[model samples]
Target: MTTPLATSSSVFLQGLALSLGLIVAIGAQNAFVLRQGLRREHVGSVVLFCAMADALLISAGVLGMAQALGERPSLARFLALAGAAFLLLYGWQALWRARHSNQLEASAGGNGISRRSALAQAAAFTLLNPHVYLDTVLLVGSIGAQQAAALRGWFVAGASAASLCWFVALGFGARWLAPWFARPRAWQVLDGLIGVTMLVLSALLLRHALTGL
Candidate 1:
């Protein structure tokens, strides 16, 4: 029916809009993606992996899959503990890199992580974090479930499309702006920022761990 089609389309549009709005805000994920893109390293796999992960999450949400996922108390506890630990570990590493890697920018040239390492790390960072599941699986899924049944699919589709488009654009687009990040000081600044972001996120996760998310 025309009514259903219209509803579905609108839902998709809404999903797409929300997804773009949320994802575009600066974060570690975006930073890494941009860095990889600028260096022209494993751009295809990284972009696709991020998008596909989003697609899976979006699909799960639309299909009301979280209902089952959310019911597992032991799994929830496990993820929470694991995520918290990871945040702390990554935060320390980021800070260490910020302090130690400042001088290496000249010799290292833009190769932050190797091609294979970049791919693996990007995938790990994107997928291994339970926070991602919470965002895409729980948060997005919950929202999708609240929508009208026919519109749900479209909404998830729209959100998934947003992830796909944004990551691709961001990854490839970064190379054009590589000139600005040429200097060692620039790398220093970048690492400092990354360190700060990691620390902040780690603190937030630690807080959630203690106070209940």
Candidate 2:
């Protein structure tokens, strides 16, 4: 028989590992967060928003709130289309920047963009992506609900904690690589990779939307 303490610890570890695995990938969201971190512009707000968003979504999943969303197949389809369009546009912009900019410069506070704009963009990147809903809400929620009733809350907490720690590290720790990214070639490579990632993600979204995959 599993002790309560052992069960809780196991569930917490499961949540942490699952969340970290889901998030620590090269996607549009992470790419945007990294760029903001490199720019040193509103990194705190961006990181906070992303982390909070994840926590909120994870909580919703744990509470079985995604059931409503699951019932709305049309909503998922619409989001997939919108997300694909946005990804395509963003991918094109990244490619354009790669071709034109000599290097990706840090956006200092002098860049004139408001913190509101940064937060809004980060929000869009987080909430507008349908895959985020599918992963965090459907998959994670279903898995959490399958666990013992007493263990679900701890699992959610562990996942939420992982989200917070990962975003903070990604946002604040980005500056360490600033020196390497200061080169024109580095910018080109980075932007090229971003472009490719965006396009691939876009294609996947489109495919899923059309094929109901």
Q: Give the number of the best model, judged by lDDT.
A: 2
Name model 2 segments beyond 4 Å from true. 1-3, 65-112, 177-213
The number of clashing residue pairs in each candidate reads 0, 0
Q: Residue 14, candidate 1: how far off, in angstroms?
A: 1.1
- lDDT of each residue in 183-204, candidate 1, tens digit only: 4465556555555654554464
Q: Candidate 2: what lDDT? A: 0.73
Each candidate's lDDT (Cα)?
Answer: 0.65, 0.73
How much does candidate 2 score in TM-score? 0.62
How many Å off is the CA of 20 in candidate 2? 0.7
TM-score of each: 0.60, 0.62
lDDT of 1: 0.65
Q: Can you write out model 2's per-residue Cα lDDT over 1-213, one digit (the tens) per residue?
A: 444897799788767756765675557787677788877778999999999999999989867733543676676566666656766786787777678645434443345458999898999999999988976876566546545567888889888998999889878987875565457777677666667766775686678678863
In model 1, the clashing pairs are: none
